[model samples]
Target: MDSPVQIPFKSFIQLDSKSATAIYLQIVFEFIKAIQLGFLPEGTKLPGSRILCRLLGVNRNTLIKAFDDLESQGFIKISASKGTFILSSQKQVVKKEGIRSLPNDLPVAVDFDFKKSNILDNPVEGSDLSLQFNDGLPDARLVHTDVLARLYVSKLKRNRNNGVWEQLQTQAHLNFKAQFCNYLNLTRGLKIAPLNLLTTTNHEISLFLVLKLLINAGDKVVVASPGYYFSNMSILDSGAQIISVTIDEEGINVINLREICKAHQIKVLYLTSVNLYPTTISLSAKRRIEILELAREYRFIIIEDDYDFEFHFDNNTVLPLAAIDTYKNVVYIGSFAKSLPAGFSYGFVSAPPDFIAELEKHQRILASGVDVIKEQVLTEWIEEGEVHRLAKKNKKIYKERRDYFVELLHLKLEGSIKFQVPNQGLAVWIEWLPSFSLIKFQKKCLDNGLFLPKTTLYQNKNLIATRLGFGSLNEKEMENAVAILQKSIAEVLIEIR
Candidate 1:
């Protein structure tokens, strides 16, 4: 072939050192864009990696990585002696930037009211929140992965006798279901069967599955006001109208819930009764019984999302609603996400076996069922008492962190914010004083490299409160975070004054 064509490279792209994107991936994207825009035509030989690196002011290794990625993705081809060439297969007409294509019959600019759906209407961009004050996430750095590795390797070796496909086909997961049943019975005071249990990837997925089975179009679903937004959004996605019931320190206002039931025939009631999301308040025992009775009377399914039950600070955690549920009206869900490291999160559902069967059937359509290796390893953890050991260890550490965070927060923020130290979970509900603005405080915190989840910034009438989680952060991190938070508060309060 003729000598490769050399093209000007400086006009195309520039790299930002502060950007989260890797330099190699940036190089790849720009090259893809260049090829698409016909600036580098098909069969065009790009400059050598060394030349390209010098031109772009990037490392030769980075340029090579970009070239390798491009070739792997079929964007470019490489030869033993020749440099990289843009593949002819990539030739296509590129849409002009800042322009729209409209049919001749339509108006150049359509004028119509486009209302955003509930899920799409969220003003909070998830990517902006870097330092998440998650409701109750475990410090994964503290998890004992060495024990898990041993168990996983042992199980892997044993599982080699049978193929992975065979393992998937058999009743292997039932062992975990059985193990979980026994564990729950011992810890939470519930008598359940393996058939009553269904494993899911996460609490959100389990909640969505349960809603799909219970909700119908036009049906009324009740959720606590300022509840888990994800669950509420899922209900809206299911074509059901949501009835928001207010929650106080005693949890979902049962009296108000009774009134809601009187007016609407509720098909489902979603709640994080163990430790209510964003507030970290447990549902009172009186309300628990009353709500179960209401569930029976109103003929609705109660979804109790006991999401971080493993990290209860107070030794006296109230039994989960499902543990005491007698009317078969409650579906309980929990996650080991907070008890162990991520990627090992084991979310599970315990409902009447018949309902679980339906949920499993729906699950099968979406997935090939659970990952047997993970299930096997987790089952070993439960059976060998490792799960209990980890939870017990984390609970003490979390309590200490929670207390330290509270002390630091009080020292720094004293009169500017008022809070109640939560009894059970990993976070505290702190109400901002009327003199300061929440949005402004959050912006200041973000500027200082601390991200507060928007869910934590709750507003009701004139009151503004946020749940500051302590479980995920260490004592040192908590101190730094609180110091930054105090500084942010001072700046915001000054502006307000």
Candidate 2:
């Protein structure tokens, strides 16, 4: 006899036949509510299609069609190996419409309260901090939060008195992105127009929206294996399947991408283009063209997150795929949180202008609009040349930090760890010996009052690593963190040895 299955149903929909709303939409709204309440977690697996259809008493097509609708909206991820899982984090941050794929059967209702926070307020103890590898998060204290405060005040005042701010009044907000674009063109060689831009609340949102627009239900989406895990989360959560490609010193395996596409009908390809997560290796120029040509030939959309593109050590910048996209298939995304002080919250997405308009609709549909104050204040900062000035200064500082951190890291870890050298981007990706788990390594780091963005944040659990942001630490602090990490690793490695 087979053992009984366990499926979470606490947040499952209760359909009323006489109700005016459609049943599928009713299901969608209920799931969205569950997500908002944390009853459904990001990547929560649903039952198989036949099981879901039988349980819901709905036809397979209704479930399949509904899932396609939801996948397009960025709500859920469905894969052969993983079945179906919710895409959104229940934060109510983005629009999750009435869409979901039905898996075939039911199990016991899941106990949902078990899955909420991303960070442990007090993480598990004995985390490693001695080895010095970590991420670069801008100090919040350095940002113009006071101006942001005033911008919010002004927006509230204006909204209370005049109702919603008209789109006309907000046109000035484009200047924020416009100024950034000019800087990118002049300094980084990535030419972009204001018309091709859409701003989001953060870097992740840009990825979320891009995945939604390009991927359909059951479609194959390619990503670098051991790449950014959140991108994996976002892609899988979006109701599509994942195709993990190998990455090397140069970047994505272009030949592997072609093979995957050949074997599967890949709908989208996502890459960092500049410096990729975990590895920090920029895809080579020859490979970049190969990807573009393949995208055009295969009709797959290439999503270039270009995240942290502004932060490169070399005077020569790697141009975005969108900049060279004569076929208009490249969707280029940039983040303010990486370059500017994070917590200030601003980033922009640029694509074909028509797509920008469509994607902006998704952005508005997600947050109504970014915090009006963030946009305006950020606009002011950009126009004043402050954004570029700080960026230029920090770029050099971050480069120094990367160099020094690595120098000390080499001293401590020696042959125990490895990393890739990229021409651009923020985080230096380090791969630990297979003996180390980032989830375990990160826990060790947090115990020391030394918090680094865990490797899994960008890719999957198997990628045991962390992004050591030189931007987050100064010369003295850098040395201290490195020494601390070395001590942590030496102790751990000794036990294993």
Candidate 3:
């Protein structure tokens, strides 16, 4: 247009004709990347679309589309009747006379230090593996993300006229809490009220809250050996001494727990009653009753994490111990993550009203409150019966996947691995033959584009097992992963031989 304004960015924008990404998107991405990489400084004007199109050998419409996207994404700015210029690469950086300056200038260099807790460790960064089984997570694709987004948007608009503070203090939270208690009552046979429930971001947070309330320094708490590592971490963070009881076919050994309780003044006992973590074995009905009786006699707390209550295969699966906790000793917690979409994690703890009140106080100090918007949308989903619908749908799909996965395991590595056909949950516990090392097998799998973490490998003095989840994988991914796993086992076995 006016003699085609010149720019130095011609070398930065390269288009791959055969790329799966659209040409316009490629241009937009390159320009944004250039800004991010600081090749283009703040307020540096981009070449005119006419000149850019001629330089890049792209259609004028395509160039314009790229320019529009860059401007819309805040990577660039276009002034009417003026040229397009790069936005400040750092949003916080100010542009003065074409020079970027921080809003707050540092007087001196600052160094930061952080102390690592013995309980909580840093998160493991993920690799670019082709497929990896998670710890019994639901298929995110099955979640009604579109419906949830629409519901959230509707709630936002409805709350637009209300003040932010008012919105925070709205009855939506109370309503959701009530609905959640009702859901628990119907499903778990627990007569819980809204006052007995406290909602957190996830089960971990709920568990932490319970531990904080119950555990004191050097106080004794029992956990299953090689159990939910995160829960054990929470207990340690709360300054509680741990007594690990072994888990068997019927879940954690109650006899061992009784011995530990007698030896130590046990304050808390954390267990997954429905489907134990890693090992999807439900605690027997008799053990559940015994544990409840022991808790009352010993005056200890039971933190029940029923994370996969909805995925049971049988109709008459044992009701949660909390349902029949006559002494009000159980702090029942459950996660919506197994039932809802990814990025949506909400959990509730149903305990005595006094415990909940204390937990609420601590929760207020930690976070302002539960996400009101999310709470409202979830309430709508519950009332509309979408949660139940989705849970039922997920259970059906997971059951099918579980069956197919177990079948594939048998077909592929029948003699190499021993496993129990689980009745519920998303994973199968595969115990390796005595000859093979799971560590070597895991490393080989990771080397072959499958990311099985060592933490997923449960090893004691003699036993080695792993929980390979199938809920998140489709048929094709599952097949490929199983094949890789089989090959990996063979490779490891050959090395040992």
The numbered model that scores best in TM-score is 3
TM-score of each: 0.74, 0.67, 0.76
lDDT of each: 0.74, 0.64, 0.76
Model 3 vs. true fold: TM? 0.76
Question: 1-497 in candidate 1: lDDT tens per residue?
Answer: 35432466666554544222356655765676666455676788877777778889999887887687677556788987976788876432111111112232533334787653423224233434335566556677887788778877887787777756674535667777888889888887778998888888877788878878888899888888666756766887788887888888889999999999999888889888988886778889899899999998888888888877777777687889999889988889887645656668877889888999999999998787567888888878788887887777777888888889889988988987887788777788888886444545665786676777545666534567777878889877888788888888888777767
Off by over 4 Å in 1: 1-132, 161-169
Question: Across residues 1-497, which tens digit of lDDT does each residue of candidate 3 receive?
Answer: 23335455565665655332357756765775566445576778767777777788899987876676566545678887888877755444313212233344434333777663523543332445558877777777787778878988998888878766565656778888899888878878999899998888877778777877788899988888657766766777888877788878889898888898888888889888888887888889899889999999999889898888778776777788899888888889987646566456687799889888999999998898567888888888788888888877777888889889999999998888898898888888888885554545665786677877535766544667788878889999999999999889888778868
Residue pairs that clash (backbone atoms under 3 angstroms), model 1 = none
Ten contiguous residues minimizing lDDT sum, candidate 3 = 93-102
> Per lDDT, what order, best first?
3, 1, 2
Tens-place lDDT digits, model 2, residues 244-327: 888777788888888988898888888887777656777789998899999989998888887676677776677777777888
**Each model's Cα RMSD:** 15.7, 13.0, 17.6
Top lDDT hit: 3
Report the lDDT of model 3 for residue 105. 41
- lDDT, model 1, position 98: 13
Model 3, position 73, has a per-residue lDDT of 46
